[model samples]
Target: MKNVYIETYGCALNKADTFIMETLLEKEGYKFVEKPEDADIIILNTCVVRLETEERMKQRIKELNKFSSNKKFIVAGCMSSAEPATVLSIAPNASLVGPQAVERILEVIKSSERKIILDGDKASVTPRLFEGKIAIIPLADGCAGNCSFCITKLARRKLRSYPLREIVESAKYAVLNGAKEIELTGQDTAAYGLDLGGTIRLPDVVSKVAEIDGDFMIRIGMMTPEQAMRILDDLIEVLKNPKVYKFIHLPVQSGDDRVLKLMNRKYTVDEYRQIVTEIRNKIPFVNITTDIIIGHPGEDEEAFNNTILLMKELRFERVHLAMYSIRPNTKSASLPQIPDSIKKKRMHIANKVYEDVAYSVHNEYVGTISRVITTELGRKGSVIGRTINYIPVVIKNENAQLGKWYNVKITEASFYDLRGVLV
Candidate 1:
């Protein structure tokens, strides 16, 4: 059998797409290889979220070109759909496939001539039974937002939520196959069912999935503040389900209303604050995670300070910090840009503030005992588990079994993770 090597980049949605592609290709008798050197076919499932990521994807495609003379190379994912010219410029002979065209990966692989397949929305593909203990399920393919700094919207345009029944069935399949954690991901999970009608159906989807007979914990993905506000009450109600993880990934891009308006984010800083406050009030001790983009265009010193102040007030358990980089064809790219030095300085300041808050939050968990389920093996020969709220805890015990629950006593704490011992 011919060997295929696939390397993926970007978020959980992209990773889920890779898993689907692998399952489809494997069924066609293609053996997956870890290293590109050992494979007859190599696929780069790319990401073009930021300028740096696009450059990395181009560089990887260029490097893979050397092996193109001997092996068949395929370029797929966001880069393939949004920036095919760039991919072709680096690797002319590589077959191109889009994020929506994942189901056609095998057809592209078997073709003798170079192919460019970038059509269809394969959002309904109930991902084959994942071999891992954690199953990442894509609830939808695209988002409904038009954030000015976002290039992903260009690639994955419009919202296309998967059928609720299909998603629930996939979750059931995954749990029956021994998955302990089910992560429902999308471009904007809160915008689910917007395209179908006026009503938001994310709460309904989560409720149905929670009904599935399983011991798995469900992790709801990132949601924009505006979208979350529409169904905030229902969403919180669904989150209260014991099967759902109390982790909230809300990307309040900027803390200043001016910057938020410049970025085309619908909600203001006050609106975002209210959402955070409400969620916290309803679900006390919930692991509230947020994303922050520092140095976005038109962010002044006062604006940046506002973000810092908000971070201090929120005390987010985790912060997905990103430095604003120019993405081609994005509205923010055409705006007056921030200096790299200034952006770097702001990034350093934000990171330091975030680290302080994070360390303090994690420190609270130290000396506390919590029941956790071992999910995966950690780096440095430790077993990684997560509390009911999705707080990552690393256990030093070698005897810890994957997908098994244990009472762990928190012994140590860090800015990012907690070290614990099995009780």
Candidate 2:
């Protein structure tokens, strides 16, 4: 068996793609290698979320180039397609593949040639590449929206939904294989099935997965406010299933209307607030998380203040904060760029606010018994799991096993995660 090494970047979707590639290549008698230097083939699954990420991908490629001068190098995922010319410029000798072209990995590897592979081949494999005690499944590729700062739109061109039957089957296979945590991922998970013209919807998919009686938890991925609003009622109904985790991650980007407009976001701050309010009203103890871009173009002090005020008001359980970075070919790239120093300052302030709010809010959860799915059994027998509300809970028990749902009593709480003992 020829040794192959793969390094992945970006979101869970990319991780899932890497797993698929690993499985496919392994079936064809390829052995997984840890280091690039020891492998005959090297794969870099790159990310193109921001300009810095793209640059980091190039840097990694350069470093790998030094290690495996005689090996076949393959670059795939968002960066390969988003900036094909740039990626090729960096490593003209390497083979490039896109997110949609993952199904062709076997053929590309067998060809023994250096060429760009960007086929939008539909994934036909029934079992996922990396099904474990916990699994992540991408329900779709590409996105329905074209946010100004997003280069993923260029990489993942169109929204392509996996057949509902195939997705449900995959979910069942994961569970049968002892998976207790199944994360349904995509560019915009809530926008699933819209590309199939009302044949099915996100709620229908969730309902099907929930019906597959497994002692596992399903996490529906991030939803855009626009998609959530479109199917808010349906989503609420689907979430009523106990099998689905009581959590929703919606990337609001910014809470200021001016900043929202400047970023080409479709929803207003009021609309986002209302969605959050409505979700909380219907679902008890529902954990809401969001993404925030701290210093976007034209995001003045007043706009930034609006964002802070709104986040304080909403008190999200977690906020994935990132200082806006310009990406090539993005509409926001040409706008008045915020200085790095100013962006860092805004991000620091936002971090402090989030810490204060999160700690204060989490303090109320002390002395509560929560059900958590242990995903990682850390060093010294400490198990780190996520509660039904998606808060990380660290359990100091030696007998804990990964992927088992346990009743953890919250004894202590922190701004970032919860400390609990598994009973």
Candidate 3:
């Protein structure tokens, strides 16, 4: 039997793609190994969302080449589609496959010579069994936005949502196969069904998945403010289902309308604020998470301060903060760039605001009793679980089974996690 090792990076959608690739390869009699050194074939499921990530992928490919000269290397994922030349430059002999070409993984592996393949076909939604308690179901490939700073648009150029029936069936298969969590992922989950002329929306998809007969939590991935506004009422109604996690991941990007316009985001700051306010009003204790990009092009002092003020006003439980870096071929890259020193300074300020708000929010849950589902094993004989609102609770128990629910009493809280004891 041939041995293969696969390493993946980036978002949940990319992780789902890796899982699909593995399922395909395993059926072809390939034995998966934990380490690259022990395998005859090594695959790097690459991510190119950030400039640093692309550089890291290059470094990793170079290092792997030195470690195993005889092994066949395969490069797959977003980098394969967006920057195939750079991938080839790093590993000339490696077979390259794009994100949409995941179903063709077996073909690439069976080939003896180096080949560059990019089908750019619509994504497939065939149900496949995964060997884990958490099953990531990608609802679609690509998005509808044309953000100036986004490089992913170059790779996944169109929005192609999976059939609602297919998605529901996939969720059923995953739950029946022992999955405790069903994570619905996509480039922009809220933009689902747009390409199909709005026959269905993300809320409808979530409601169908929640109706599946199983003990699992459904985690809806990131959604843009523009799309979310279209079906905000329906989305909130679906979120009220007990099976759905009360976690909202909305990426506002910038808090100033001028910066938002410059980034090509369709919504204004006031619109984003209204969406946040409505969701909060409906679910007061919901864990609201957001993404923020600092030091983007044309962000002046006042604009940056506006972001800080919005962060303070919103008090987001978690912030996915990033410093803007130039991506090749992106419109933002061609414009006037921000100085690295200023970017670093802005990042520092954002970090301080995030830390203050995060600590304050987590402190509120210290004395509350939360029902948590044990999701993963943690450090030093501990198990980690998540509350309905998706707050992570760590308990010191070695024998905790995955997918089991427990009523945990919150004993302590930290900046990032909560400590609880099972009741």
Candidate 4:
């Protein structure tokens, strides 16, 4: 039995892919290694969400390539599918297992020579991966959107929504295995069932899983604004369930209509606002998080300013800011890009606004009492938990137990988390 080391990057779905691979390998009598230096083989589950992330993956692959003599290196996920030339340029002997071909990891690992499995493979439900109190169930793969700035669609090119019954069964298995937080993830969660003859939608899946009789919380992953709006009424009704978290991730990309049109986002600033307004009207305590790419092609000073104004108006509970950089083969990459200096400046400014607003909003949690579910251990003997509305709280008490609910009084606040004391 050979020792294997696996490192994963990107979203929950990627993590799940790594877990599935590990599970299959372990079942076949392979050994797990704690460090890449000690492993006979190493796998890097990669992501290509941003240009910066792609660069990081390249450097990391180079560093990990040193551990093997037989070229027993594997690169998994979107980078393998979309950036095969770049990956091979660095680790020429590395095997590629694409997003759609993760089920073929065993073949990639066992072959004596370099192998690539990127297509004509199917994903089946494997054992759910749960650590501490969290479990991630990838609802499906691929996205329905064709945004000009996104390269991820090229990798996960098919919209394959898993069967609703299978998803429900996976949820049941997770709950039975003591998972306290279940994340329903995909490229576009709202794009679910577009190929299923319109029989089932995202809300139907959520509602079915909510009926699984568990103490776990259900988190819906990122969904396109336009796609989400189509199911808004039904989605809102299902989110009212006690087990589902009132959180929505809608990436507006930019606030200016011209920039959005250029990016092919399929939704305007006003349309994005309408989705938020509707969600907030029904679920007032909802935690609305958004992603903002600081600079994209066609974003002028006015466009950037419009984004800032929109952020102020939305007052998102959390804002994930990224400075745009060019990616190959994308329409935006062919256009005149915003200067790196300008992108950095806008990112810094937007980040400051995001931090200030987040701090102000979090400060309101001070002196409030709420019940939180202990999910993870944090720094300096602290325990991490989430409020019903999904506000992360760090309880500095050593007595807190994972997966248990505790009523606590928030005594301090930071932009990232709230400090709570057991009540």
Candidate 5:
């Protein structure tokens, strides 16, 4: 196909997959189009994170199937590999490619008959998701965690850390390409470098990139508690660099020890909090964001209350809350599931608790002047800027320029963000 149209979904890893597809097709003289109506090849990079997400992906696939008679349509990404039968049942005529098989996109595009390439890891493809604004570097693929509820582990099979030099070079390439923000991401960032000999770890990677001689800032991605504990001292050292954003994302999942044990999480609540305490003691301005699953199986009422208490004690800058929904073939799926009503109730309570703490923390920013980097345009005609600590500040003016720093006076605050006006 001469023209390709790709719609990416899911996490940064999937976006990086689309970037690989774009880079490969461009080398063969293929043109990318904005809309599917104007393209010869249509590809939908699907996500299967939640049952609801799969349903949404199915709807999108059906809409794109109408173009299959004229266009060479394909279904790619996590769902292609994890739920191959489900995808084929919906669009049997379309070619299928897995998340790991991104490099073979051109092969599927060239074949006339239905092609399916969903075997294993294709380490040859190094994703450079530089969309002119930010450059996302996938330091590795897969993870070393054995969490009971994660279906992503099935889609992305193993821990394959890319070479340290190559990963560092990708960061250099991004900065040279005018990207102001460099994100070091992987399935489990703290677990990086274990597949490579034990010499290099994530701290080594971040330190090398920080020395790349650029005005860019680095943001490290999510780290499982067990792995983050392994490299806390070293991680803290690299994060001290001015090039790194004063932020950390640690997905503790649940706060109760009973729930954590049933979920097969390696770290305890105290262990997770110690990591948070250390980061706060060393870098007080660092914003810590976390994830919490409200209603996992085996979470008793006492366990649920413990989580609420933890939230009040920690008061994370942002809490990504989710209701536990069982995914097929996962360890937790076989266990007794909490009722949907219970999960929904827990999610609502957790959200209310989250908003209470979030608003209180954000109110501290009001009536203060701070410098922020204008990053993206908000959906409401304002420009979104972020402080050094990564707290989003909405400069309520449409004419603000991006990629530049502006001094703003904080006028108001919400649980979501800070609203400011140019000083």
Candidate 6:
């Protein structure tokens, strides 16, 4: 069997895609390798979320080019989808595949071709899980919405959902293999099943997975506000599932309606607030987290202030804040960009606010006891693990194994993590 090494970058969805691709290659008589040096085939699963991420991918491609003279190098994922032409320019002899082309990975690996663009013609293929305590079931591919700053449209062109039965079987297989977490991932998870023949919906998928008797937790991936509003009742029911983790990672780009409109997000500030309010109202103990981009092209002080105010009001348990950067094909890239100084200042403010919000939320857990699924043993005497609500807790336990479950009592809290005692 030919040796293959796959490297992944970007979100959990991308990581899941890499796993799927690796599975396909392995079935085609390829042996998986940990390092690129010993492999006959090297695949870099790319990301294009930020300019920096794309640049890093470029650097990697260039470095990988050194060995390309002797081995088969493949560039797959978002960077390949968004900038196939540029990728060709950098590694003039490599093959490429977009997010939509899972069926073609085996063919690409078998062939000795250059500048191959294997995109579209979507089909359902059950992905292979190689390792770990978590099983990522990609229920859907691509995204339905066109947020102005997003370049995902270049690669993840259409939203396609897998058959509900297929996804459920995949979850069962993973659980049988000792996976304690089953994460449902996609570009827009809530947009699942729209392209399928029926109106099955995302919650239906989650409920089905939860029905499987096990000690596993289900984590739902990113969802747009539009989808959330459409299936509010079903979503609420899914959140109430005991097998499902009590944490949601939602992206609310900005707080001002005008900025949201410019980004073509299709939802108003009030609409977003209502969705979040409903989620909180129904799942009171749920840990709500979000992604916030500071200093978009037209964000002035007032718009920035609105974001800060809303974040303070929501008290999001966690926030991934990024300073906006222009990408070539995105609609927002052509607009008059924000000044660097102003953007930096806004980012600083947003970071401070996010830290404060995180601290406040953490403080509430200081006296509470929660069950932790141990993931690692810390460098010191502490054991680190994640709670069902997705909170990272470090407990002083010297004997806990990596994949064991234990109850922990919160002893202290910080802005970034929590300290607990194993119960």
**Highest lDDT scorer:** 1
Clashing pairs in 3: none
Off by over 4 Å in 1: 129-131, 198-200
**Model 3 lDDT per residue over 164-235, tens place:** 887888889899989999999998999999988898899989989998997999999999999999999999
The sequence of per-residue lDDT tens digits that candidate 2 reaches over residues 258-366 is 8899888889999999999899999978999999998999999999999999889999888899989999998999999989999999999999999999998888878
Q: Higher lDDT: candidate 3 or 6?
A: 3
lDDT of 4 at 291: 88
Query: On a 0 to 1 TM-score scale, where does candidate 6 land against the true structure?
Result: 0.97
Task: Tell me the tens digit of each residue's lDDT in model 6 across 293-377.
Answer: 8989889889999999999998899998999999888899999999989999999989999998899889988888888887656
Which scores better on TM-score, 1 or 3?
1
Q: Which runs in model 4 stand beyond 4 Å of their true positions?
A: none
Please give the lDDT score for candidate 6: 0.86
Candidate 1 lDDT over residue span 1-423, tens digit each: 999998999988899889889878767778988899999999999999988898888888888878999999999999999888888988889999988888788889889999998766546775865756999988888887899999888778767778777788888989999999999999889988887785548898888888888688999999888889999999999999998999899999888999999999999989998998999899997888999999999999999999999999999999999999998889999999999999999999999999999999999998999999989998878899999889999999888989999999999999999999999
TM-scores of the candidates are 0.97, 0.96, 0.96, 0.97, 0.96, 0.97
RMSD of candidate 5 to the true fold?
A: 1.6
Find the 10 residues in a row with the least total lDDT in model 4.
120-129
- By TM-score, how accurate is candidate 3? 0.96
Q: Which ten residues in a row have the lowest lDDT in candidate 2?
A: 123-132
Cα error of candidate 6 at position 197, Å: 3.9
lDDT (CA) per prediction: 0.89, 0.86, 0.88, 0.87, 0.87, 0.86
Which segments of model 5 are wrong by more than 4 Å? 120-122
- Runs of candidate 2 exceeding 4 Å displacement: none
For residues 196-294, could you state the per-residue lDDT of candidate 5 as single tens digits?
776899999898989998677888988898999999999998888888889898998998998999999999999999999999899988899999998
